[model samples]
Target: MGEVTTSLQRPVTNTGRSKLVRHVDSFEIQPPAPPSHNGVPRSAWARARRRVSRWHRPYITLLLLLDFAAAAVASLIAIETFDQSRAGFYNAEQDPTWFHTVAFGLLPLGWLVSLWANRAYDRRYLGLGPDEYKRVIRAGVAVAATVSFLAFATKTDLSRYTVGTALLAALLLILLNRMLCRFVLHVVRRNISQAGHRMVLIGTLPECLEVYTAVTRNPAAGLMPVAIHVTDGYAAAKGIETPVPVYAGRDVLALVREVGGDTIAVCGSASSEPGELRRLAWQLEGSGVDLVVAPQLTDIAGPRVHIRPIEGLPLLHVEEPTLSGPALLAKNLMDRVAAGFGLLLLAPVFLFIAIAIRISDPGPVFFRQPRVGHEGRTFRVWKFRTMYVNAEDRLASLVDRNETDGMLFKMKEDPRVFPVGRFLRASSLDELPQLINVLKGEMSLVGPRPLPADDGDFLGDVRRRLLVRPGMTGLWQVSGRSDLSWDEAVRLDLYYVDNWSLAYDLSILWRTVGVVLARKGAY
Candidate 1:
């Protein structure tokens, strides 16, 4: 009875015991079933966390809230302005209740929708270039058109004056709000640690270096280079040394992940094949990574470039630069009218400057220099004399001390300038006499700076600047004037020549005011 009981408790043979041992071994070797919390995998939770962190939620939320508030305030201001204007002008059937509902509620909603449709608040556009402002203006115009159409369709006796005034006021207010937001964004972007997208550059050493340099210089662009994947050769071969680590490999996605980069910027087509790029783009989708392909073409604005897709190839259609047309005619008319009005308004100030210059030195109150103008024609450019009579003779002596780029002669503290001349140069009052040039049609309100006839090195593509009349204040003046390098000045001039428009001229003129007030790059 005891033996029978032991046999029942123990294994029948070594086979049973070995089978049990094998089962235990299997349980230990089988990879501990991926850590689970509440039946969900740890890997899934990690992915969700990464995705949530990648979103610029704070910035986007704040910007959206600000825009909504701006729209509300704009609507209120527009309503008030319309009421005041209507009361002062045309007598219209006043329906306060209806007007208030439409103006404050309907109008703001429509305007907001229009702004969204036009991509006014796009992350790519905000805080960079004039795209955001352009979108705002486009939306405003669209809203105005829609309002006009609705007024006509409904046959509502809406006062044209009231509608027009409200639209104008709303447009201006929106612009002001956007400008303020842009200023704030600029401040935020100045700090590298606090702002910008972390980018992993993928390109040949030279191409990547060029892009890296531009990104570093323009912090407001919000692209910060964190790592570089050199495709063609070693960075040393290209004489490029970046603060960021240099990577070498074909696995761009892995490299981006290793560097914690949110963006992958491909500099030029040579960086990767079309098939590879397509694959990379596919892999990056849903990965919270932005891919930016930098085309070989540089310094070209968006308006001139149009993408035409044909046979699976995206062909870029670059419109030829127009030097003349209706735009030029309008610009000419504006320049004449503005110059005439300015001369009249500034007559007293101009007289004071002339007298001051005459009293300071016994020389001509005005300086007329022969400059190359439109179509390479010679024109006498006018300026309030801010130098001694012997300034021309002294130029040779000061050449060695020139503080500006070699192409342009500039002296911050030239002996040839008298005390009044120095003040005039510093204040840019010396340029006031150019208003007469604008009136005479020898100069424009905005264009490339007129090079002196003696400075004949501006030939070839540089001479494209002569396609339009030289300006009293140009991209060169507002950008940096004497402080800009020769290449930078020429690039700006070329860009202006290639993309001339009334809106662009007006923008430059507006910026010119602020630049002059700041006295940046003056003298």
Candidate 2:
């Protein structure tokens, strides 16, 4: 819910029924009839659901065991390092070793309870996103608070060193362990086609297709669309082909059961025939299937959106982006500081690259191009030259071979790029010189990527990207770089601009490391 200001005005729909337009609008379009079920046996869907649950439970169990082991190892290390022999509990009322042994046994159990209470073990948060890590941190803090409170209340001589070390070590171990587990899970999900939730999509054909496209793009999300259930009004809509099995009927519950769908994604404009959603919810009460509503909103991050309940109705409140003020100043300061440090640290590497380039090609080591920055201002962006001296001259001939879509031109195997240039481009070593651009305040470390002046003039919603300084590495670079279409890249950039935050910047930076190392979508 980053401030969504669309140039297109909202079309006037029939609002006479009620404050909320819940019913489906009648359209002349007719959808295709339900296809034959011969291609996909009903049991296949059930097996997929069962397989996902089977894998997920063991994964959760493994996490629980790993959590226990991390806590136990931390406690053991603490006990050995800070022996309770010198620090008696409650004026030496009990033997120090016995008391310490008992504490050690209870510490890990207590930690597990804390983790369970904090929802760190919640399946929804596992294998994706930062919520899992955040929950673990919260649990660690809770454990430390409880320890301190108990010690103070009992007036016991509990060693602070032992408690602090155990908590810190346990938290670090748990996070690292989770990272490993998640990595393995992602690998399995990517390699194993059936390793995910079997979802039945319910909505208009267009909306269902949109959701299907978005979910399938990210295999790590683990939402496999097994089928699509078109709403009543759009059941007869035509002229569109669906990738998955498409079905239409009033008995959604029966459809879900028949297909053994573990999840139902109610996409935009789902049938709302007078508490249609409520009735569906009631039907799914005891069923293991989960109901997820995909709102029409797009490119809105959770931070900018707030759920405000007004008389039981939930309204999404979007906050304006932080383009200026203290946060902006901090971002600028970070760019300069990090750029300066990077330049210093990589001085030798830079020299080696410069020398190599100079020997291999008879041109300048650095390439400077005029690019649009904040507020449509143009600046010379510096980058290690990765193309031959006559590269620009060859652009016209290669126009037809452009592999990318949009005003920008890109060729996966451009003849203009010399032998070493390909390596530089693939490794993104060519972008290292942009540290100079960053240090000069012409660019940021994380923001929308600057467009070359010749690309085209920006207008309307696209211009919103220029509200902030261009970045050396933005969402586009980390997402797919040359692999993403122009529209998708622009959408990501606009999303970044509208949802700028320190945490988001840091997250993008972290992901950039992996992207660069993997050389994904780089040419």
Candidate 3:
């Protein structure tokens, strides 16, 4: 019998950034989450539990299906090709029959089972970024090793060739499957979430605004806000934006009690200390309302924070970011290998683009601008110039026509763009020269987008973005390059920096192809 009109979930794509779908979890008038506190005492684990536990099981199930299919294909191909090739050798490998085929099929089956035993089927993993993939990979390696050991322990001569091929195929298939899952889940979740869960938001006026903004922004999570509780001191200033009605003072709880809200969000930066916080939690429990707290802990991801019970107190620990040391080594190797191969593969495309740029405009084909990069170092970012040669000089004249948040300048029809450049930018063909930046170690295949010198002042608030190399197509580019507001751009960049992983980078690149093809919010 609870009431809420707005929908839930975040915008699935950049094109929907300004669509004003209800925020999935804004603070202003948001239902109480399961203990979402920020900073000193972060109950992020609980908040994440609600999120990851829902998705992980489905994600893992998909991975299991992928493993079975990939292994079937690999086993068949390996047995046919490798066995025949070995037949001519003096020490020929044993050929497989139906018995061997059955055994071969069991290899991936065992691997999938191992993955499940390793908690791969946990629900807290679906639609998440990339740690989920890493876990799959880690589990896959262990499972493969176990199979190899079993082969050696037993007298059965399981071909190394078969195992290797199966592993490779499984990895590629899982990667592709994960990307497809992300797209499909996004579509389905956005459509079906409106019918689920009802909750009410009760928080201080200022804090309520923050919560409201978040919930208002992402509506696919299906949160319908029934009412908002405004604090006594600030209730007069509650003239703000939100879809729900605001009730002043402690009576708001009675209002939520009346509506039977499932959630009560307490957003008080200074008023609610540890003891008061627990008291509020107790009240929420008695009222049958799930309690959620919104503190100002921006940019900290769930993985970085660990909670442990010491005696009766819950202690939270935050690990340092992995931008250096082993992570950097892995990233460096990946960058060089991927960049080298990309440069070789795209050589003809580069040549064709150079020719096209030369033919289109008389200006220099390559655009080099001073951009802030890793560790706040300034480097020249390369691009296929998509503007007139004097476009920089012409910025002042077009300053008044900015379509997005004032921090960015855009014209639906920009005259400074050379005719071909419009298509080039829309298709992201203009950013090809960044491969050169990657070669020079000033950029990566996937990282934060480099900012110009004029945008330097904002770095004080968002310095984490410089922890890694800049990229040609980053979260910013794939999410909707020019469509994001200044704040949204920084949020995406920080999120990427805080949560860097090989699988996440691959997802971005995979999504990049779709973003480019769909041509959404690119112009």
Top lDDT model: 2
Error of 3 at 345 (Å): 4.3
Tens digit per residue, CA lDDT, model 2, 1-523: 1111111212233454323222334322223224323323345444323423456788889998998899988877776786555332544335756665646667778888999999998778888888999999999999989888887897777767777888898999999999999988888888895557889889887888899988888898788887787774444544455687676543565566666678889998784455667667766655567788888877788778898999877788988888889988888899999999999999999999999899889999999998999999999999889899999998999999999886578888888998888899999999999999999899999989888897778877888999999998889999899999999999899989988888889999999999999999999
Ranking by TM-score: 2, 1, 3
RMSD of every prediction: 12.8, 9.8, 10.5
How many residue pairs in model 1 have overlapping backbones? 0
Using TM-score as the measure, the top candidate is 2
Task: State residue 449's C-alpha deviation in candidate 1, in Å.
Answer: 1.4
- Candidate 1 local lDDT, 324-346, one digit each (tens): 78888999999999999999999
- Kindly list the per-residue Cα lDDT of model 3 for residues 1-523, writing each as its tens digit: 2222222333234355433433323222333333432234333443422311134445556767876776666666665666643312223434435444453567668767776776555544545445557767877788778867776787554556655766666666766776676667667657765332356565565666677676545554445566766554433443455566665433344456566565666665633565766756644443435566665555566677787989866666877767778767887788888888888998898888888878988878889888888888998988888888889899999888888773457786899998788988888887877888898899998988887866645436478788788887788877777878877888888888887777678878987898889887776
**Which scores better on lDDT, 1 or 3?**
1
List where candidate 1 sits over 4 angstroms from the true fold.
1-56, 78-110, 138-168, 191-193, 233-239
Quality of model 1 by C-alpha lDDT:
0.74
Candidate 3: TM-score?
0.67
TM-score on alpha carbons, each prediction: 0.80, 0.86, 0.67
Candidate 2: pairs in clash: 30-236, 30-237, 30-238, 31-236, 31-237
Ranking according to lDDT, highest score first? 2, 1, 3
